[model samples]
Each structure stands twice: as structure tokens, then as C-alpha cells.
Target: MSAIALRGPERVVIHQHRRALWSAGALALMGVAVVVAAWLWASSASDTFAGSGCSVENTVRGCGDTVRAFLDTELRFSRAVDYAGLAMMVLPACVGMFVAGPLVGRELESGTYQTSWSQSVSPARWLAARLAVPAVLTLAGVSVLSAFSAWAWSRAKGTYYPRGDWYEREVYGAMGTAPVGYALCVLALGALAGLLLRRTVAAMVVTVLAYVPLVMVLNRVREDLWPTARFLGGDRPGGDAWPVDSGMLTASGRAIRLKDCSGGAGDTAACMRDRGGVTAFADYHPASHFWPLQLVETGILLALAALAVALAFRVLRRRHG
Candidate 1:
């Protein structure tokens, strides 16, 4: 097969990792089953309350048992959805560790990569195939999980459980392309780490260490990626909005944090009036900002992934050639 087609290397990589691939597929299917079952359970439980005319907000004397049952089921479903989101959040780290340790690092550590290189498979081709196969599999799996997560979030959101906001850290990562971007980025980073360290355990540890801080920094700055809407005076964003900043506005229109003004005798309003504060203000990203933020973060991660892939290939060529 031609190098451009990558058919030969692709086959070799797939065959080598077939066991791991099957295991990953089984896990993905199990996740789908869990999500489906949880949704069904919640929906069925909801029927009891629906027929009784008792919602979470409106509970009558005779509807106690029905409400309790509905709440129990809804809480379970909510926990399932949350756990799924947490899994999606953790998947990139798992992918990175696997790519670093078993995929690339183990071969290089054991000198097996040389065998592949000697068999007319150039170093570049070998690395590309290694990256491509896992990338495709990870993408497919994450996309499927993300779709279901989004579905689950939509179904139970804004109901009794108010924990599934789109902007929330776990929900945000699981429901959109951001998780895919993060996985791809970590995958490339793992390959690069493996190439640079040339040790399975070392590369895995480094990938995890590097990824943790990267995610932390991204989460810290995520709200600033897009411009926030400003609301002055009595106007405020809806409950679903992600509040970025809130403070009191001075008479001259300068924004000062509420914490800066000390409440005299515990009277915050009196303190605010004494400090030239005219009105309260808030800055937030409404629900419409979800797509824009997701796109921006995903774009940044993709660029980083491309950079990591280039670095990995460059390192491989420099050392081998």
C-alpha cells in the first residue's frame, strides 16, 4: 500500500492493539446502555407524578409517596448523568496515559519500533499510523458519548435537578466538541512525550502531570474566552447564565467589587451609598454563549494538538534518521 494511503501501517497498528480496541468498544457500549436505562427509569418515574398532578414544586398531601418515588428516580438519573460527564472529563487523561505508555512508549522502550522501521515503514509513517488509529477510535467513542450526554442533559435539565447547566465544568466538557478537542490534544501530547522520554512509565507520568495543569489553566480562563454581557441597575441575566463578574458601580461609572466596600454596622446598602456606589452590576455569559465558547476552546485545543503532532514527528525523525 502507498504511504499516502497508510493502509499497511494502519493494519499493523490495528492488529497490534486489537485487544485494547475491543475492550474500549465494550466499555463504550456499556456506557450507552447505562445512559439509556437511566433515561428510561427517570421517564417512567416521571409518569407517576405526571398522572398525580404533583411536581417537585407543587406537592400535595396525598402525593407524598408518589413525589418521593419520582424524586428518588430523578436523583438516580441525575447522578448517572453526572457520573457520565465526569467520565468524559477524565477520558482524555486516560487516553493520554494509554497512548504514552502502551501505544508508543512500550514499543520504543522495548526496541520493537525499530522492527517496524526496518520493514520499509519510515519512522514518520509509523508514528502517523500510531497517532491516526487511536485518534479515530477516540473521536468515535467520545462523539457517541457526547451525543448521549447532551441528550441526557436536555431531558432532565431545568427540572427538579438544577445541576446540569451547559456552562458547568463537567457538563460543558461532555456535551460538546470540547471533549474531542481535549482528547486529540492529549493524544498528540502523549505521543510527543513518549518520543521525547522513550520510557513507558516516565512518559505516562509526564503526560498526566502536563495534562492536569493544562486543564486547570483552561478552566480558570474559560470564562474570559468570550465577551460577557453587562447588566446594570435592576437588570440581570437569567438563572442559566454563567456569571463571570459582579460588583457595584460607582457614580462615575467605574466598577468596584462589592467586597471592596465594608458594610458599616453590617448595613451593606448604607455602606454602598456612603462609598459613591450608584447601582449594582453584573457580567455574565448567557446560554447563547455556549457555542461560541465551545468553538473557541476547541479551536485552541486543535491548534495545540497539531503543534504536538508536528513536534512528535520532528523528534522521531531527528533521533532515528
Candidate 2:
């Protein structure tokens, strides 16, 4: 809470936004509470089948009711966690809009930032202070929420109620450093938008517009961030693997489009054989590629953030200096 490492401009920034900071803290605390409560509820529910030797795949004859009850309870918990994950995903855009509108654009639009610059504070220093204070607070808050979210996910995932996967869009970002990367990226983008637009509402809208497309692109290309494992013939990846592509392989090792033979499907297998498709092929990323994918995507986001930060500073200098 104390801006001891921060000097005049930074401390002033913190003071100016004290209420918003406190509200953010309160919200983070509420998120933690929800995650903890749901985790406890799910854990207690899991105990019902501890020694009953009952599972979702294989249920004992008399344990059906008990298993159903546990699944129902776990389903609620799963929903809570999934919702939290979704919130985490949306948080970056929220942060971006706030930074663009009230934090930077309002001051710029009202010409209040000039007052600070006249007080022996360089424009670069003022902007740096604005970025630094929020960056630190945002990083700390998001890291905590993501950690708790990941903990909650670990408890209910792979359970009978709401089956989850690591590669799932809602589950992936919240469970790793990707959220932090996204937040920082959007924060920088927001600042840049604020500086460029110099209008509160315009900056906010532009920030969100920019952020949404970036997220969509990243999500679409996420699987290609790392190398995929290939399986051929009867070999196949595990159930938990993230499938990238699949098709049939010809005898000459050429890949064939499975859809091409779908026109006359008297026997699909026979059609494949006629087309010289001797084996099935698949490309996927196993569970082991989780960290690699996370790291690579995070690295890309951080790189974009750094670029935006540079551009923001450059724009500020050109306009103010």
C-alpha cells in the first residue's frame, strides 16, 4: 500500500487514485473468498466417494445416488471456478479501459497533466510514474487472483461434474502467467490509446477495440506457438492431448484429406483403402506442452507490451517536449 520506492510523481498518482485502488483490493479479496469457498465445498463433496470405490466411469450398484449427489455438488463448484476463470480472462480488457479513460485520458483531456509538468516534473517522468504505480498494483492483484483461481481449478478439474481440460480457452489463461502478460500488455496499450486520443471515452473505446482483436488472434494461434507431436498408424495421443490436425496418410507418405472421400461413404474405411490411405495421422500437443505454450504466448504478449510502452513514451515526448 505504501509507495516507499516511488517519489513525488508516483506518490501523487497513488494518492489521486486511492479510492479506486482500495475498491480494486476489495474486489480481489472477494474473488479470493469465492475461490476458497468453492474449493472447500468441492473437497467435502469428493469425500463422499472416498472408500465407496465409485467413479464417474465405473459406479457401484448401490452408490448411484451418492455419486449423483457428489457430482451435483461438484458441478456447482466447477461452475464457480469456471466463472472465475472467465473473469480473469476479461480483467485485462477492464484494466485497459480504466487506464485509458479515467487514469490517463481524463487528465490529458482536461489539461491537468500540464500542471504537473510545470512543477519541475518532466513529461516522461510523469508518464512513467503513471505507468509504474498502476503496473505494480495490477501485477500484484492479478497474480494473487490467478493463483487462487488455479488452485480452485485443480480441485474440480477432471471431476465428473464439469469436465475440464488444460487446453480449454477459459481454463488456460487463468491457470498460468498468461493473465499477467495479458494485463501488462493491455495496460500499455491503454496508455498509448489515451495519449493518442486525448479524449476519455474515445480512448476507452479504442483500448477495448484494440485489446479484443489481440486476444482473439492469440487464442486462435495459441496451438502453433510450440511444436506438435505427430502420431501415425495405430499410435495416438492421449485423451488429454490437444489435437491440432488429423487426416489419413497415403502409402507413399503423402497426406490425404479425409473429406475428399466423404462423398461416397458406403464404407469409409474401404474408401480410404481405395485411395491408398494406409494409416491415420494426427498432430497434437500433449499435457507436457502446457508450460511451453504458456511461456511462448506470454513472451509474445510481453514483447508487444514493451513495444507499446516505447511508443507511448515516444508519443508523450513528441507532444509535450
Instruction: List pairs with backbone clashes in candidate 2.
Output: none
Considering summed lDDT, which 10 consecutive residues are worst modelled in model 1?
1-10
Candidate 2 structure quality by residue, lDDT tens digits, 1-321: 486665799899988888988898888788778767876776777885676688777886888897887877777787888788889989999889888988899999999998998999999998898888889988888888878777787777656665468898888988788999999999999999999999999999999999889989999999999998988866668768998877778878887765666777497666777788888888899999999999999999999999999999999989887
Query: Lowest summed lDDT over 10 consecutive residues: which window, candidate 2?
Result: 155-164
* Model 2 residue 318 lDDT score: 92
Candidate 2 residue 151 Cα shift, in angstroms, is 1.6
- The digit string of per-residue lDDT tens for model 1 on 251-301 reads 798877666655536776557667787898989999999989999999999
Candidate 1: where is the Cα deviation over 4 Å?
1-6, 52-65, 262-275
Q: RMSD in angstroms, candidate 1?
A: 3.0
Per-model TM-score, in order, reads 0.90, 0.89
Candidate 1: residue pairs that collide:
none
